[model samples]
Target chain A: MAPEERLIAVGVSHHTAPLEVRERLAVAADSIPTLLTRLRDDGFSNETVLLSTCNRVELYSVPGVRGDANGLARWLAETGGVMGRDVESTIYRLHDQAALHHIFRVVSSLDSVVLGEPEIVGQFKKAYRLSQESNAAGPVMHRVMDRALAVAKKVRTETNIAREAVSVGRAGVELARQVLGSLEGRSALLIGAGDHGKVVARSLLGYGLTEIVVANRTFGNAVNLAQQFKGSAIPLHEVERYFPRVDVVICSTGAGKILIDRDQLAGAVSKRRGRSLVMIDLAVPRNIDPGVNDLGGVYRFDLDDLAQIAGRGKEAREVAAEEAERIVESESERYWRQIMNEVVTQRIGTIVQTADAVRVAELERLRSTLDGLEPDQVAAVDAMTRAIVKKLLHQPLHQVRTWAREGEIESVESLFTAFGTRKEDDV
Target chain B: MGSVLTIASIVTILVPVRARRLAQKNNAPGGIAAHRNWEFVAVGLILLGLLLMGMQSDVLPMLTVQGGLRTLALFVAIGWLVLRRKEKMAAAGMILLPMAAVLLVSSLLEPPHAVATSVGSPFFTTHVALVFLGLGGFALSFALSTLFLIQRRRLKRKQFEDIGQLPSMETLDLLNFRTQCLGFAALTAGVAMGVFLLTQSASGRGLGDITVWGTCAVWFWYAAGLHARVVLGWRGRTAAVFGVVGFGSLGAVLTVVTVVFGGWHGS
Candidate 1:
C-alpha cells in the first residue's frame, strides 16, 4: 500500500484531554526533531509530523508495515512517560478522510482552544519544517501539509474569524483600551516578566503604549524584557513605587500570595488624582489583591474576566466561523477525493502495463509467422492485437475504479492480484 | 413645518440609538457603522429645520421663546456634529439628542409671543444670540459630562460588558473642559452687553432684578468650576460633577426667570 493510503492521526488536545494530560504529552520544539526521527526509525510510521503546542500534542503519520493506530498511540504514551491506560481515553485516533479533515481543521485553527487564532498556522509550519530537517516526512507529508497550509490561507482571507482579539492577552488589551481610551502616550508596568506577561506587553505596545516597565523576581529577566521595548526595569519589591506613574499595571507573577493590596492601590489612586488605572491580573492563585478592585479610579480584570472579554470576541465572530467551517469541509472533501483518485489511477496504470507486457511477449513469439506478411498487414495484425488487449482490459479497469470509489480496497487488491499485477510491478 | 422637521429629526436620532443598542447586544461592527450613518442623517435633519426657521422669521429667531428653543436645538446639533468629527463621540448623542428633543418639544408647548420690536438694536440681538450660544455650549458639556460619569461608574464597578462604545474618561474630561471655557467666555461677553444696555436704558432693570442675579449666579458658578479645573488641577470626576451641576443650575434659573417671572430685560 502507498503511504498516503495508510494515513493516521493520534493526539490529545484541549477538547479531548485536560490541561495536565496535554502538558504531559507536549514535546518541546528542540525535542521535535528527535521525536520525528524516532517515529520513523522505530518503524512506527513511514512518514510523520509531530505538532506539539500548548493546547495540543498531535502526531500525524503514515504507518509502516509493522505500524498501526494503536501502536502510534502507545508510542506517544511511552514518549510522555505515562501509562498507556492513563491516556488511552483521551487519545483520539482518526484514519483516512477523518484524519485529513482533522488536519485541515487544525491548520485552519478551527480545532484550537481559541477558534480562529493565527498562531496555530505558524506552529504547524515549524513542525513541518522540523520534520523535513529530521528526514522523517517524505513526499506524502509534504503534499498533505502544503495543501493544509493553502486551505488555511484561503480560510483566513475569505472569512473574518480572525479579525477580533480572541486570545487572552489581546482581549485584555481591548479591555484596557476601553477603560483608558487611547494608549498612545500611556505606560504599562508588567510584573513578572514571564511569557504570558511578555505577550500582554507586546499587545499593549502594538496598541501604541509608549513605555513598559518590567519587574521580575529575577532582576536579569526584568532587565532583558525591558530592554526589548527600550523601557526600564525595577525590582519586584518596588512595583508599588511606580504604580502612580503608569496608566496600566499587568500582574502575571507566579507568587502565591497577594502582591498589591487595596491600601497600596488607594495610595496610588490618591497620587493619580482621578487619572484612570487599568489592572490586569493574569496570574493563578491570584497575584494582586481582589479587594483592590473596590478602589475608585482603578479597573481590575483577572483571567476569568479576560476570558469573558475573549468570549465576547468569539461571539462576534460566530458568523465568520461558520463560513470558515464550510470552507474547511469542502476543501478537505475535494482534496481527499483527489488523493483517492490518484491512488486509483496508479493501480489502473499498473494493471494496464502488465497486460501490455503479456501482449508484447506473445507477439514476439509470433514474429516468425509474420515474416511472410507485407509491412501493412503486419501493422494491421499489431493494431488488432493491441485493440484486443484494450477491449479485454476495459472491464477490469472500470471495475477497479468502481471498487475504489466504493471503498472496497480489499476487492480492488484481489482483482489486481488476479490480473497478475504485483505490488513490486509498480514503477 | 418647523415642528414637523424637528419631530422628524428626533425620530431620526432614535435610529442610531437603536442601532447602537443592537450593536452592543450582538457585538457586531456593521451595526456601529449603521449607527454612525444614521446619526449623520439626524443631524442633517436638525440643520434643515434651523434653515427653514431662519427663512420664515422676519426678524432674528432669537426674539421669542420658541425661536430660542429651536436655536438651542440647532446649536447643540451643530456642536455634536463638530465633536463627532474629532473622535468616536457617538455615546454623547444618547444625552444630547434627547436634550435637543426636549428643547424642540418645549418650543412646541410655549404660547407664541410677539417679537419685541423696540429691542431691535444689534447690541441686544447679538447679546441674545451669544447667551443662547453659551447655553448651547453648556448643554454639550453637560452631555459629555453625563457620559463621563456613566463610563466612570462602569469602570469603577468593573462592569466591562456594559461599557459599550463610550469614549475614555480622559477624552470626555478634556472635551468638557474646552466646552466649559467656550461657554464661560461667550456668557461673559453676553452679560457685558446686557450690563451696557441696562446702564444706558431707562427700563429700570438692574442687578436688583431676580433675572439679573440669576444670570450672574450662573456665570459665577461656571467661572469657579473652570478656575478649579485650570488652576487647581481638578479634573475627571470633579470636572464632570461641576459640569452637571452648572448646567442644572442654569436650567433652573432659566425656568424661573422665563416661566415664573415672565420675560426679563424689561420685556
Candidate 2:
C-alpha cells in the first residue's frame, strides 16, 4: 500500500463560536484560491477544502499530517488574522470516521444553525468547486465530496427534512404574520435588491400582501426587481422615508456596514405612531442595527432570531433528521469498507507481481542445466516447479486476504514482509 | 348460492376497514394493495349476482330488496372508481364501502319473500333500479361530505395525518355537489314513474299512504338542497352539512317506508 491515509476535518461553526468570531473568520470568495495554495505549500494537508459560509468555516482534508491538529488550528487562526486572540478555544479537530461523519452531518444540514436547511449543500458544492479548481482536492477528496453530495441528495429525497421552509425570509414572514394576525392588505418594504430580500418579499406576497416597495443601492436594479413583483422602486437612501407607510421591512444588502441605526429608525418609528413595525435583517454583518430593537413598537430580528422562528417546525424535522443520519452512517460505513478493500487488493496485486518476477528469474537460471537433458524431462521439471509454487502460495495468500478483510492490516503487512515479497527483487 | 354471493360481497366490501387501519399506521403500500384487492373482489361479487339472476330467466328478478341493494352497491363502486380518477378520495371510500357492505348484508337478512315476482311490472322494475341507484349516489355524496369535514378540521388544527393521501376539502365539496345533482335527477324520475304507474295499475296504495308521502318528502328535501347549491351559490361547509342532513333524512324515510308501511311496491 500507499501508507494508511485518513479523512480529517477541522472547523469552527455557529455552535462553537459567536457571530463576532465567525464574521472575522469568514473567508472572502476571491481569497479561496490563495488559501488553498497556502494549505498545500505549508504542508497542512495533501487534499484540502476550505468551506467558508455565514455560519461556519470548515477545512476537510485527506492524507492529513499526523499530530498536526494544533499546528493546523494555529495556521487557520493566523490566516483569519486572529492569532493569539483565543480563537483556538472555538476550533475543533476530527479524524478518521469522526471526520467522515462530521462531513455527512454538514452536507445533510443536520449541523446547520437552522436544522435541515438546504443552503449548506450548495455552499459545500461551491467549496468543492474551489478546491477542485485550485488542484488541492485530490482523488480522495473527489471520492469523499461525491459521496457526501450523494448522501445529501438521498437525505433530501428520502426524508421530510427539506420539505419545510427553513430560510430566514420564510421565518421572518411567519413571525410577522403571528404578530399582525393577517398579511392581507399589508404593505412591505424590501430594503435591498438581494436574493434574500426578494425571498422575503415573495413570502409576504404569499401571505396576501397588497403592496411592496423595493429599495436598492442601485436604483435601476431596484426597478428591475420591483417590476417582477409588481412593486414600486426607491433609491437606497430613501428607504427609511417610506418605512412609515409599510407594515414590514426586510433588509439584506451586500454592504458590510450597518445601514439602519437606532437614530434613523427612531424617527421612522415615531412616524408610525405606535403601530407595530416588524424589521428583519438578513445580512451577515446585519444591515439593520441592533439598537433599533430598543425603540418602542419596533421589532427587530437578525439571523439568530430567524433561526429561532425556523425552529418552530423543528420537531417534525428532528424525526426526519434522525432517519437521514442513519442513512449517512450506513453509507459512510460502506464507503469506508470499500476503500479498505481496494487498498488490500492493491497490496496483494503487488505481492503477486513480485512473485512472478522471482519465478521467471529462477526458471531462466535453470535453462542452461536443462539443455543437456531431453525436452520431455525439461517440460516435466517445469510443470513440477509450477505446481509446487501454486500449492505453496495458495493457503498463505488466502490467509493474508482474510486477515486484511478482518481489519488485521498489521498482520497482513507483517506476512508480506516475512515472505520477502514486499520489495522488488530481480532474483 | 345467491346468499353466498351476498355474504362474499359483504366480506369483500369490509376489506377497506383493514386497509384504512393499515393506512393510518403508515403501511401505505400494504394498505393500497388491500384496497385494490377489495375493489376487484367486491365488484366481481356484485357482477356475479347479476349474472346468477340472469341465469335463472330471460327477465331477471334483480328488483327485489336484496338484489336492489346489491345493484346499488355496484353503482357506488363504479362511482368510487370514477371519482378516484378525478381526485384522491380514499377517505370517502374508506367510510362509504363499509356502509355499503352493512346495508347489503342487512338486506339479505330480510325474510325470503318472492317480492320480485309479485311486482313483475316493467315500471316497478325501473322504479326500484332508479331509486336504489339514486340512493347509491346520495350515499357517496354523504361520504364525501364527511371526509370534507374531517379534512377541514385537520387543516384547521394543522395536524396532517395521512393528509398527503386524502383529497382536499375543495375536491370533496365539488364531488359532493356533482353526486347530489345526479342523485336528485335519478330520484325525481324514479318517484315520477312510480306515481304514474300507481295511477294506471289500480294499486290501492295511493297518495294517502305514508310510504308515498315519505318518498315525496325525501324528493322535496333533495330538490331544495340541489336548488340552494346551484342557484344560491351555497358551497363548502354549508353544502357539506346539507348533504349529510339530506342523506340522513332520506335514509330515515327509507326505513319508515320499508318497515312501517311494509314497502308500497311489493312487500
Candidate 3:
C-alpha cells in the first residue's frame, strides 16, 4: 500500500491568539534551525516548517496531521509560555485540509491586519526557505505551500488587488486633509525631503495645497526641492519658527531627538490659536512623539501607525479582496484533492501489483498443461492472458479514479491498507 | 485528377522557393500573412477542394468544397485579425475575398459558361482569373500603402502613435511597386486573353470596342502608375494615391464591363 500523508498547522497568530501570544511563538530569524530541531525531536518529521511574522506564527507539517497537531499544540504552549487554557482556546489547530486552507488565506493577505497588503507574500517565501534550510519540509507540504504562493501571485496579477488601494504616503495625505477639513489658504509644513515625505507633499499639492512651506536640515537643499514643486522653501533652523505660522505640520525627518515634541508643538498650536495640526511621521525612529497623538486638535501617525488611517485602502481594495479569496479557496481545494489522489493512487498500485503476481502464477501453471501447443499458439495464449488481465483491471481502476475525484480515497485507502500483507513499508 | 493538376500548379508556382521568399522578406511581423503559418492549411484546402471536384457528385460537392474554402478563408482572416492582431488589413482582406468567392461560386453553380462551349471559355476564364488575381495583388499593395501612409503621416506630424504595424517605409514602397507590377502583368494577360476569346467566338470580334477599350484604359493607368513609381521617383503619399487610382480604374472597368456582360466570362 502507498504511504499515508497528514498535514498539520499548529501555531499562534493574531487570529489564533493575542499579539503577546504570537510574539512569544514567533521563531526568531537566527533561531529557526534550533526551533526546527526541537520540534523535530519532539516528533515533527522532515515535513515540519515554521512561518513566523510580527503578527502571526504558524507551523506546518505533513503525513500524520491531527496526531502531530496535538504534539505541536503542547510544545507551543510549553515553549511560548501560554497557559493551557489559552493554548487550548487560542492556538488554532488545523489538520490536513484545514491546514492547506489556512496557508492559502495567509498568503493571499486576507489574514493580514491590512487587507491586500503586498508584504505577506515575500515574508511567506522567506519562512518557507527557513523551513527548507532546517530540513523540515516534505513533498506534501512543499507542494501545498508552493501552490499557496502561486495562488497569491495569480490573484495580485489577474485582479486589481494591489493597485486599487491607496499607498501609505497617500493615506497620510488623506488623513491630513481630513484633519484640516480644508486646504484653502492653509500652509502645510513639510519637514525632510525623503521619498515618502516628497510623495505626501505632492499628494498635498494635488489637493489644492499651494501654500506649502518646506524645511529640511539642509536649507539650500530645501530651496532646490521647493522651487522644483513651486512651493516656498525655509531654513532648517527656522522649522520651529514657522511652526506657529503653519496650520499643518507634516514631519518626516531623521532627527535623533524628538523633532516635534509635545512641548514645542503645544507652543505652535497656542500661537496658531488652537488651529488643528496633522503630523505624519514616516520615519523608523519616529519624527514626532507618540505622546502628541492624543493632544487636542492634533492627528499624528508614525510609519507603523500609518496602517490605521490606511483603511481608505481597505475600502478601495474590498472589491479585489473578494476575488483574491475566491482564488485562494479554489487553489486550496485543488491542493487537497491532489493529496487525496495520491492516497487512491498508492492503494491502486498495491492492488494491481498483487493481482498481476497471482495471475502470472496461474498462467504459468496453465501453460505447462497446454505444452503440446505450437510456438504461435503459445504466443497467442500469452497475448490472450495479458488481455484478460487488462480487462479485469480496467473497471476497478476506473472506480478507483472516480473515488479519488469524489474524495472517497480515504476510506478506500484504509481498506487497501487492511488488505495488503505489507503494513510495514513507509508511505 | 483535378487535385493532381492543382498540386502540379502549386508545385510549379512554388518550386523555385524564390516567390515564397520574396513574399516573406517583404511583409512585416504584424500578421499571419507575414508569418505564412497557413502555408500548409491554405495549400492543403486547395488540394482537398480540387480533389473533391468531379471525383464525386458534381454540383453539390463543387459548391460544398467552394463553400468550405470560403469558410476557411474567413476563419483564417479572423484568426489573423484577432489572435495575430492585424485588424486593418484583415478588414480590407475581408472586403475583397468575398467578391472573388461569390463570383467563383456562381460560376460553379451555372457550369461556368457551358462545358460544350468551354473550349473558347478558357480564354475568358483566364480573363476572370486575371481580374481576381489582379484584385488580390491590388489588395496586398493597398494594405502596404495604407500602412506606409499612416507611418508617413505620423512621421510628418511627429506623432508616433496609431501608425499601423508594418515594414519600414523603404520595404513597404518596394513591396507596393512590386505588387503593382505583378497585378499589371496579370491584368495585361487578362486583357490579351480576353481579346483572343472574343475573336475565337463566331461573332464579329472588335478590338477597338468601347468596353474592350475601357479594359485597355485600366491597363495603361496601372502601367503609368508603375512608370511613375519606378522612374519618376514618386513615393509615399503620391505613389500610394496613384496605386489607389490605378486599382480603382481596374475595379471600375471590371464591375461596369461584367455588369454589361451580365457577369465575367458571361457566366
Candidate 4:
C-alpha cells in the first residue's frame, strides 16, 4: 500500500467557541500568507489552507506523514496565545472523509454560524489563494480546495441554500427596499464610516440609491469613504440635521449613548412630512433608540431585529441546505474514489511495465527471422503481436480496475502475487 | 385532444401549488425550475388546444368566447414566463399558473357555438382581437397588483420568507402601471373600431344594447385609472387597487355577456 496520506482538519468555530475565543484566533487577511508559511515551517502539514472569518477559524490540511493533527493543534494554540489543552478542548479534529466533508460544508456555508451566509465561500476562496501564494498548498490541497469550491458552486446553482440574506448588513438593505419600495431617487445617511457601515452603504448603493451621506466621529475617515461613493461627508454631530433629508439611516458607531432617540426621529418624521424612514443600528451598544420604532413614520431595526429577520431567512433555506448537503456528500465520495484510483494505478505501474518488456523481448527475438519475409508480411506480424499483447493483458488489467474500484487492495495484492510479481518489486 | 389540454392545464396548476409548498419548505430554486418547466408544458398544450379548436372551425377566430378565453390564458402564460426570468419575480408562478389554468378550464367547459350569431366582418374580427388582447394586458396588471399587495403586507409584518424572492413594491407597481397603460390604449382602439363597424352595419340597436354601454363603462373605468396614475402621479396602493377593480369589473362583464347573453354584441 502507498503509505496512506491522510487529509485532516482541526478548527475552532462559533459552535465550539465563544466570540472572544474566535476573535483571539482570527487571522487577519494580510497575515494569512505568513501564517500558512509558518505552518509549513513548523512541520505541521504538507498542504494547508487557513480560513479565518468572524464566525469561525478553521485549518484544513493534508499531512506529509500520518498523525500530524496533534502538531497542527499545538501550532494553532500557540498562534492564538492559548494553552495546548485549552485549544484541544475547544478544537474539532476530523480525518479522511470526515475531514473532506467538513471542508465542503464550510465552503458551502452549511456549517456557518448563520446557516447559508455567503461570506464563507469568499473567505474560503481567499484562504485557498493565500495558501497557494505561500506554497503551503500542494497537490492534495489543490484537489480538495478545487472540489470544495466546485461543490459550493453546485450547491448555490442547484439549490436555494443561499437564497436569503442572513447577515445584518444585507437584511437591513432588504428591509429598507421592502419599506421604501426602491432606492432609486432616494438618499441614505450612513451614521458611521466604520466597516459594517460601509457594507450597509454598499448594499444600499447596489439597489440604485441615488445619494449617500456618510457621517463619522472622525471627519477625515468620513470624507474618505464618502468620496468613494460620490457622496458628501458630515461630522457625527450633524446626523440629526441630515436625517430628515435622507430616507434610510445605517448607524454603526462606537458611541455609548443612543445617537438617534425617539424624540429626534419623531421630529425628523414630521419634518419629512411622514415620508417613511428606515433606521438600522448595527452598533454593539445600539446606536438608534429602540423606542423610535413606536413612531408612526419611523421604522427601526436593531442588530437583534436583524437577527430575527436573518433567522427567518435561515428557516427559508433549510430545505435547500439539505439538498446542498447531499450534493456535497456525493461530490466528496466521488473525489475520494478518484484519488484512490490514482493511487492504485500508481501501484500497478510495474506490472504493466513488466508485461510490455516481455512483449518487446519476444518481438525483438522474432524480428530478425521476419526480415527475410516481404515488407507487408513483417508489418502483419508486428500488428498480430501487438494484438496478442493487448489480449494477454486485458483480463488482468480489468481485474485490477475492478479491484481498485471495490477498494479491494488485498485482492489486488493476491492477484499480483499470482502473476509472479511481488508488491515490493513494483516499488 | 382537448382532454389532453385539460389534463396538462390541471397539472400545470398543481405544479405551482407544489412549487409554493416547496418555497415554503425552503427549496425555492428547485421549485422555481420545476414550475417553469411545467408552465412551458402548459404553453405547448394551450397551443395544441388552439390547433384543435382551429380544426373544428373553418377560421381560427379569437373573438369567440372559447377562443378569447384560451388566447387570454396563453398570453398570461407567456407573460409569466417573461416575468419569472427575474429572480425577484419567481413567486409569480404560484399566482399566475393557477389563473391560466382556470381560464383554460373555463374555455374547455364552455365550447363556442358552431354557428356564428354575429356578422363576420374584417372590422369586427380586428375589434375582437384588439379587445381580448387588451383584456389580456389587464389580466397581467391584476396579477402584478396582487403580488405587490402580498409583498407590501409581508414587509409590514417583518416576514422575510418571500421578501427575497419577490420584486420590490416599486417594480411591481411600475409593471402594473405599464401593462394597464397598454391595455387602455388597446381598448380605446378596439372600442373605436367597434363604433365604426356598428355604424357601417346599421344594426339599429345603436347605444341601446347592454354590450355597447357595458363595454363603454368598462373602458371608461380603466381609462380613469390610467388617467389618475399618469397625470395625477398616483401609485402604490391606489394604482394596485384600481388595477384589481378595473380588471375585476371587465372580467365580470365579459363573463355575463359571453355566457348568459350568448352573443358578441348582446343580441
Candidate 5:
C-alpha cells in the first residue's frame, strides 16, 4: 500500500564519530519515546526507529524520504542541539540495501564494542520491541527487523560470537592467585575503584580470601568500595601501612606515577619474610617495575605481558567460528529471498486487479451461453482461463524477483523497458 | 588400520605445517584459520594412531606389538607438541598424547597382564585402570600447570595486550587448577580401588607387593595435596610444586612395578 519502499540509515557510530561527537548525540533510552514522537510529528520520518547504544546512534527510516534525505540530517543536528555543518562532518549516510544490510550486520555483533560480543543481540531486540510499541514501524521496517533479529539469533547459536575471554580484572586476580597460591589467610590491598579493578577484587574475594583492604587516591572512592565489600576503609595517607600486611597487592589507580615501585613492594615483602607476595600492576604507565618479577614469589602482571599466555586455546575457538559463519550466511540469504517474494506478491496483485475487470465481464457472457452446460464443464473453463493468466504473468514476475535480490527496482524497470513503455499512462 | 593411520599421520602433520607456513608467509589475515585447520589434522592423526595400536594386538604376540606402538606414540606425541608450539592446547596435550601412547603400548605387551595375580580378581583389573586414569589426569594437570606458569610469566611483564592473540591468564590458570583437582580425585579413586583389590587378592589368591602398597600411599599424598589446593587455598607456584611431587611419586611407583616386577598377572 505504501509502494515498495527503500530503507536507509543516516547516523553516526563509534567508528565514524569520535567520542566527543558520539557522546553529544547519544540519546538516552528514557527520552527516546518523546524524541521519536517529536521526530515523526516533524514529518521527516514516515517510519522511525532509533538504535542508541554507547557505541552508536543510528536512525533507520523508510522512503519517500523528505527533502533529499537532508531532512533527517537537520533533525539530528537539532536533536543534538548542534549546527548542521558540525553534524554533517561526522555523520555517515548509507542508502537503501546497504542500510538494511548494515542493521543486519550490527545485530549479528559484527559491529560491537568487543568483537563477537553477546550484548548486541539483547540491545537489538530491545530497540525493535520499543519501536514496534511506539507505532513507529511500518510493514517494511517490521519485516526487516524480524529478519535482522532472526539473523542475530542464528549468528549467536550457530557461531562462536558469544565466546569471551576472561575480563581484564579477572586476569589480574588469576595471575596473583597463580603466583601465590594460598590466599585463605592472606590480605589483599585494592587501589582504584575502576570497573576493571572492581571485577579483580570480586574474583579475589570469591576465591576464598580472608581480608580485603581498600585504598584509593581519593579517600571517598576507597571508602565507598570498602563499604560495598564490608572491608576496612583506611585513609589514603596510610596506604603504605596496609601494604605490608597485604600478601597480594592489586593497583589500578589513574595517576601517572608508580603507586608501588619495586622498592616499596620489596620493603613490604621483606618485612613479611619474603613469603610469596603477588603484586598486580594494572596502572597504565605501570605501577610496579618489570624487574619486580625477578624477585622470588613476587609475580607482577602488567597489561602488555599477558598476550603470550592468552594465545593457547584461541586456535581451537577460531576453528569453531568458521563452521558458525557458514550457517548465518545461508540463513540470511534465505530470509532476503522471502522478503523478495512478498514484494513480488504486491506487484502481482496490482497487475491482476486491472485484469479482473475484463475477466469478470467475459465470464458473465460465457456463463449465459453455457447455461445448458454442466456445472463441471463450466468450472473447468474457469480454471483454464485462470491458469492462462498465471502462465502469462510468471516470466515477468520471476525476472522482477531476480532484480529485487540485486536491489528492489532493477527487474521492474527491465520489465517496463521490454514493452517499450515510458510512462504510467503507457502502462 | 596400520596403513590408514600412517597416511593420516603424514597428511595431518605435513599438510598442516606447510599450510601454516604458507599462511604466515602470505601474511594472511586467515593465519588463525590455518592454525584451526591444523587442529583437524592433529585430531585425525591421534585418532588413527590410537586405533591402529589398538587393533594390532588382537591376534599377534601382543608384547612386541605393544612395545613398538608405545615407542611410536611417545615419539609422535612429543613431535606433535613441538609442531604446534604456538598452540595453547599443545602443552597439556603433549603430556597426554605421550602418556597414553606409552601406557597403551606397554599394556598390550602382555594382554590382560593386570589380572595375572596369584588368584584371578576383578578388583585388580579395576585397580590398574584406576591407576592409569589417575596418572593420565595428573599428566594433564601437569601440562595445565606448565601452561599456567608460562601464562603467568607473560602476564607479569604486562604483555597480554601486546601479544593480542593469547587466551587470558585467568582462564589458563583456572583450567590448570580445575584439572589438578580432577587429577587428584582420580588418584584418590585409584587408591581406593587398589586397596580394595589388595585386600581381595590377599584374602582369596594371596598376591602381595611393596610397590602396590607404595602406590596406595602416593594416592593419599595426592589426595591431601588436592584438598589443600582446593579448600585450603593453595595456589599457583605452590600447586605446581605439589603436582610435580605427587605425579613424581606415582611415576616412581609405576616404574618400580613395571621394570622390577616382570611377574605377569596374565588373564
Candidate 6:
C-alpha cells in the first residue's frame, strides 16, 4: 500500500437510503464470508469488513491496488443483484478521518435510527469477527476495528446517550412503569399476538412482569405466545374476565371495532378496588376506546402516545449524543495521527537499516586494515562509524517526522524516495 | 446571617434549573453533575442557616412566626435532600425550593412576635416544636403531592414534554405517601399535646377555640385519608388529592389563627 493510502468506508445507511434500496443491498450473515472473499479476490479491496444490519449496509476497507471507492460502490451494487445506477444516488463514500469518525459513531450507535440502540455494536463486532475468520481483515483493518471498539466503550461509559429508551416497545414499557410504579408483581394481558404486540410484550416481560396472559383471535397462536412467557392463554372473549386481574392490558389485534369500551373498563376498575390500570393500545384500528382515558384510575395510551414518549427519549439522547460526538471526533483525530506516526516510524527504520547495511559491507571490505589495530581500537572504530551514520541521518529523519505531524504525507513520501528507498521497502 | 445564608441557599438551588435550561439549549455536558453538586451546596447553606438561627435565638425559635418560617424552610430543604437521594424527585425541587425561598423571605419580613406567654413551660415548648415540625413535614408532602398530580395529569393526557425530568408516577406516589404519613404522625402527636395542655392550663383557653377546632378538623381529614390508604388501599390520584387538600386546610387554619386571632396558638 502507498504511504498516503488510508481507510475508507462506502455504502448506504438508513440516513442515506430508503428501506427499499437498503434491503436490495443487504447481505445476510451466512453470506458474509463469501461476499468478503469475493471483494478481496476481485480487487475491490485488499482488506474489508461487510456490516449488514437492518438499518445499514456498509463496507469498511483499505482500498486495493486496482480499486477505488467508485469501483467498490459499483461492485457492492452488483453483488446485491442490482445495477450500479440503481443505488448510485444512495451510496456514500468516506475516506481517512471521515471514515474513522463514521465507524466510531456507528459502533457507538450515535448514527442509529433510534439514537442509542445497542444492537449495532453487536452487529459491528460480528461483522469484524467474520472478516477476521475469512482472512479478509489485514493489520490496518484490525487496528481500526480495535480502536473503534475502545471508542465505543468509552462513549458508553462516559455519557448517558444509551440510558433512555427511544424505541416504541421500550417506551411502552417505560410508560407502563410510570403508571404502575413497579412491574415486579404486576401482570399484563396481551390482546393480540402480532409482531408489534409481541415486541411490547417482550419488553414488559424483561422488566420483571410476573404474568402475561395472551389472548389472540386464534387460540393456538395465543397459546404459543403465552407459553413463551410462561403464562396462560385465554380465549379472545375471556379478555375481560382476565382484564381486572392484570395491571396492564396491551391491545394490538387487527380487530376493526373497539374490544374494550369505557363502560367495561369502568366495571373492571370497580372490581380492582382502586388499583391503577394501564391500557396500552398498540392496534391500528384502535382496540381500546379512547374514551376510556376519562375514567379515573385508568391510564390509556395508544401508538401515538408511545411515539410521543419515545420522541422525548430521543431528545434526551440527542443531548448526550452531542457529548459522544465530541469524543468520537477527538478520538478519530488522535487515532489517525497515531496511524500516521507508525508509518513515519517504519520509513525511518527502513532508511537506518539500509544505511547500516552499507556500513557493515564497507567494514568487511576494510577488515585487513582494521586488523592492524588492537581489539579496543577496533571496537571504538565500529562505535564511531555507527554514531556518524546516526548523526548524518538525524536531520532528515526529524524533518520527516515534522512533515508527518503537519499531515504532509506526500512530502514524507518524497523524502523516502530521495533517500533511495523503493516502494516495496515500505511493505 | 441566617437570613443571608437562607437567601444564598435559594440562589444556589436555582443554579441547577438554569444549568438544565442551558443544557437543553446548547447541548452541553456536565448539567446533571452540576445540578447534583449545587444541590449539595444548597443543602449545606440551608443547614448553616438553620444552625445560625438556632444559635442567635434567645429561646426556642419556634415561638415566633419569623423563626417558625425559617425552621420550616430548613426542614423542607433537608427533607428534599433526603428524598432526592433515592428517587428522581428533582422536579419536586422546582416547587419545594421556591416554597422554601418564600418561607425564608416571609421570615425576614415578619417582625419577631413576643414569645408565647407559656414559654417557660416545657410542655408548651415541646408542643410548639412538634407543631412546627409537623408543618414542615406537611410542606414537603404538599410539594410532592403537587408534583404527583402534575405527572399524573401529563401521563393521563399523554402530554410528555419535559416529563422525563419528573420521577415516575409510582415513585412520586410512594414518596407522597411517606411524607403525608410523616406529617400525619407528627400532627397527631402535636394535637394530642395541645389537648393535654389546654386541659391542664388555668388560662381560660379551652379545646373549643375556633383555631383548635380548625386544627382538629385538619387532623381528622388526614386521619381519614391515611385510613383509606392503609385500610382501604387508596393510592395514586386519590391519595395525592387528599394530601394537597389536607395541607391547604392546615395552611388556612394557621393563617386564620395568626392574622385574625392576633397571636400564635389562639392567644
lDDT of 6 by residue, A1-427 (tens): 5454467899998789875677678776778899889888877688999997656889998887766777778888887777856578689888877888899999999887777766567778999999999999998899999999999999988999878637667888988988777789999999986455777888999999998899998999999988898999989998888767889999977664588999888888877767788999876546788899998788999866776677665878888999999999999988887877887798788899999999999999999999999999999999999999999999999999998888787898899889977653332
For residue A79, model 2's alpha carbon misses the true position, in angstroms, by 2.4
The reply for model 1, stretches above 4 Å from the true place, is A1-165, A316-427, B1-59, B114-118, B161-164
Complex DockQ per candidate: 0.30, 0.01, 0.00, 0.13, 0.07, 0.41
RMSD of every prediction? 10.6, 17.3, 28.3, 18.6, 19.2, 14.8
Model 2 Cα displacement at A131 (Å)?
A: 3.2
Candidate 3 docking band: incorrect
Q: Candidate 6 on B1-267: residue-level lDDT in tens? A: 777887788788778767766776787635656577787788788778766766876666667777777777777777877877865666677677777777777777766674556776788778777777787788888888898899888887778885666787777778888888888888888889888888887877765577678878988998899899888878888989998998889878877776778656654
Estimate, for each residue in B116-202, the C-alpha lDDT of model 2 and write its tens digit: 232667787788778877887898899988887676554333344444466645457778888998888888888998888777765
Candidates sorted by TM-score, best first: 1, 6, 2, 4, 3, 5
Residues A1-427 of candidate 4 have per-residue lDDT tens digits of 2323367898888689865576567676677788887677666677889987656788998765433776677778778787757667898877767788899889898887567877677778888998988999988889889988999999888898777536656777778887787789999999875456677788889879999998988999899989998999998888878877898998877564578888877777766643567888766446787788777556677655565566775767787888889998988877777876775576567667777788788878987786799989878887887788788878887888898687576676667677666433221
Candidate 4 residue-wise lDDT, B1-267, digit = tens? 665776677677568667767777895466545555777777887878778877877666366667778888888888788877765776666777778888878877876753243446777777877887788788889889888778766655566665777776767877888889878888889999988877776557657667777789889998888886666656766788888888888878878877777755753
Q: Between 3 and 6, whose DockQ is larger? A: 6
- Which portions of model 2 show Cα errors greater than 4 Å? A1-5, A63-69, A84-86, A164-167, A189-198, A213-245, A253-257, A358-427, B1-267
lDDT of 2 by residue, A159-209 (tens): 888986377567777667644546888898888765556777888898798
State the fnat of candidate 2 relative to the true structure. 0.00
Clash pairs, model 6 backbone: none
Give the DockQ-based CAPRI class for model 2.
incorrect
* lDDT ranking of the models: 6, 1, 4, 2, 3, 5
Pairs with steric clashes in candidate 1: none
- After superposition, candidate 6 runs with Cα above 4 Å error: A1-166, A313-427, B1-29, B35-58
TM-score of 5: 0.42
lDDT of each: 0.80, 0.75, 0.62, 0.76, 0.60, 0.81
How close to the true structure is residue A86 of candidate 2, measured as C-alpha lDDT? 72
lDDT of 4 at A330: 89
> Total backbone clashes of model 2?
0
User: Candidate 5 lDDT, tens digit per residue, A160-253?
Assistant: 6556433344555556655555457767888776444566687788777788899887788888899888788876668778765777777766
Worst lDDT run of 10 residues, candidate 3 chain A, spans: A418-427
Rate residue B211 of model 3 by lDDT: 60
* Model 4: docking quality category: incorrect
